[model samples]
Target: MPTITIKNIPEELYEALKSTAENHHRSINSEVIIRLEQALLPRLKTPKDKLTNIQRLRAQISPNVISADDIDDIINNGRA
Candidate 1:
């Protein structure tokens, strides 16, 4: 196996990672490996597919004024 060394990591980020590892009952190395796997995993999506979906959704909604508060409420409540 090839050895990897990470350099110049911020102290605050290191502390956060150590805390997260402790919370999940995992070693720092294990936690970092899991995080790296998640970050590097390929997401399946074509640019055309994403644009088509966005356009279709936009067509369904009226081009009316929407408030920031309304958007926040929708996100927080996860409902209409």
Candidate 2:
């Protein structure tokens, strides 16, 4: 195993990292390693993963469906 030292980390960033590590029940070093891996290692998403992510994001949105008529009314009346 190799050891590394990081210097001059901003106070706010350190605090945020510390808070996140505590929330996840991880040590600061482990949190840094996890974060570094996430930033440096890119993984290809499978079709199912992509669909799941899209569905998850869509679920957060309001269910209001806008129609063409509604769009025309908004454009003409300058109202949402």
Error at 2, model 1, angstroms = 2.0
lDDT of 2 by residue, 1-80 (tens): 99999999999999999999999999999999999999999788999999999999999988758888988998989853
- Choose the strongest candidate by lDDT: 2
Stretches of candidate 1 off by over 4 Å are 42-80
The alpha-carbon lDDT assigned to residue 33 of candidate 2 equals: 98
Model 1, span 1-80: residue lDDT tens: 77799999999999999999999999999999989988998567899989999999999988757888988988989864
**Candidate 1 lDDT score relative to the true structure:** 0.92
Stretches of candidate 2 exceeding 4 Å from the true structure: 52-80
Measured with C-alpha atoms, the lDDT of residue 22 in candidate 2 is 100
What's the lDDT for all of these models?
A: 0.92, 0.95
Candidate maximizing TM-score: 2
